[model samples]
Target: MLSTKRAKSVEVRSKPGRIYTVLTTLGREIAQGIIPAGAVLPPECDLESRLGVGRGVIREAIKTLSGKGLVSVRPRHGTRVLPRRDWSLLDRDVLNWLVGQENPDRELLLAVQEVRSIIEPAAAALAATRATKTDLLRINAALTAMEASDSQATATAADKAFHLAILDATHNPVLQGFRGAIDTILSAVFVVAVDSVDGWFDGNLPNHATIARAIEERDATKARDAMEQVLGYTQTHLSKPKAGTRRRAGRTGAGRTLSQT
Candidate 1:
């Protein structure tokens, strides 16, 4: 049973999207470790009283969390927070909850980068072989947006679009299906990287351009290499101390220049 204080901590006022509000509040607590694994949630009645939401809404929110592997609801056992290992880390909501925490999980962020390192280079290679003119245009347009972005928010969106455009160009339905997961993780990474590392967005533009140019020329090898180089810049930015640890460094200069083939 949740303590009275703890239950009150998550209380919600009636509003539109009440279910989503309840879901996010509870999910954020779980993700941020305020509610640790193995802790059983309060009974439905208690939650109903505390959150001021209908029982059905609470059930639905728990059901959705269960689908994300964040909880296990057993007959008579109540709902228990599942171990982090059991979470569907790539699920859009889960990733958002995790990375949106005040102190984002460093290990999880690195795992996102690792996933990108494994997938994006290969996707870029495939796009080089299969991307149509329209696909290339989308990629170039995203790059142009990144170059012109004056705010961190716009730069982050453009950066995500640039990567997503390459993934779409692969023309593999299975790969294309990863769009939601990829978009969420990229947003998380870009948000953190841009805030933490000076010139994270602008410094990586040349690498992104190399990827676009290689795909346009149908050079699979160059595209893959350029994509890897772009990811390397991400790795560097992610590895740096988070913002405010030190004075923001001078604009992170471009990394190893990718020679045009």
Candidate 2:
């Protein structure tokens, strides 16, 4: 008689949050070019030992990375790192890892802002027409939180909330489809920019308030204009060198995961 044994799925089991640790460590190494493209990753057993995690955790991390286009795994060939161009750079975890790097890439951050400028203004215009009272209230509430925030981190969270609220107000699924990608870009852009510069969060409050007010008044043109102004400031801010640094002028360029309301 054939025995019926339930097969268990492999998961992270070495320690609490070991999977995250492995993912972050390896992700950063790849992002920073520590593990250069075309280099094969260390063997699974080696990573397990080095990271002090079990094989299950290591495999899971590698599987996740492979899905992000960071690595290619095959039976005969070992896991090899892929070129940065192949990576899903807009992936949330990958963006977060990039932000966590010792010196985040400025050029990448600029690219994010460019994408935002293209999408956000159009969404804000749609939001002015489509937003309900509840949407307006949410946008207002986010602005309120920004006003009340005592620290840069708190304010940045509220800032992200304000923008996300506007996007939600658009009520266009086609536009909303861009949300996930936008979220990743905004997070990496905001965190790196804010952490590097003091008072980075100060000037943006008025711009956000203007956007919310325009949407509240159902003025699509003004909403779009205000939104552009907000993003424009961000572009200018990112273009300038950080205070106290003479970084190259050519070089360019939030905080949470959210469920749809």
Candidate 3:
């Protein structure tokens, strides 16, 4: 249970925006399992007293959370935290809250990678056949930015842009519509995966360049294979090692280099 003092401590440290503060506080607590799923939130009056917020503010916060599938409310019963599977995991705020945790959920991270494996390779294959000059330019530019990036932040952004550009090159609205979801997932995963391994961004540069070059050459098969290789690096980095296993120096598992087919 979040005590009045603890809630107030969060409130004081929060930014000036009241509703956002309450929302983020509650959301973080939920994501961290501080407030576990299937638990009922305190009454609005209790929340108002605890967080020092108005009734209206609490209501609005709950409403927003409900929209994000974090909780469900009923007139007779109080708001109940829904199961993790119910969450709008792709929602920007929700994804940020989850990723921001001290130890992010491993399952969620793996799930994001699985989603990428299913989508990006096909998108790259399509881009190889359908990409216009402008689309190719954007993809190459993002790849160049990745190679030149001086910091992790820039590298992550450039990497995300490179993948999104391929989706755009597909010229399929359904695939294009995935941009927002893809951006959200990539933003979260890159922060975790890239930071976990030193030189990860630089190490993956060759694979990214291969993907771009394959697309430029209009080689759908090669583009798809290259994209799979890129995702293979992701799977290796994100996967939990067995108790007795160890990663080899200077290579991902299986002695695979980024540029290798």
Tens-digit lDDT track of model 1 for 60-119: 899999999999999988899999999998788888899865566777888888888988
What is the per-residue lDDT of model 3 for residues 20-110, given as tens digits with 9 covering 90 to 100? 9899999989988889999999988999999988887899899999999999998898899999899988777887788756456767878
Clashing pairs in 1: none
Q: lDDT score, residue 69, model 2? A: 91
- Candidate 3 residue runs with Cα over 4 Å from true position: 1-17, 240-261
Please state every model's RMSD to the true fold in angstroms: 7.4, 7.2, 7.4
**What TM-score would each prediction reach against the true structure?**
0.85, 0.81, 0.79
In Å, residue 122's CA in model 1 sits off its true spot by 0.8
lDDT of each: 0.80, 0.74, 0.79
Which candidate number would show the highest TM-score if scored against the true structure? 1
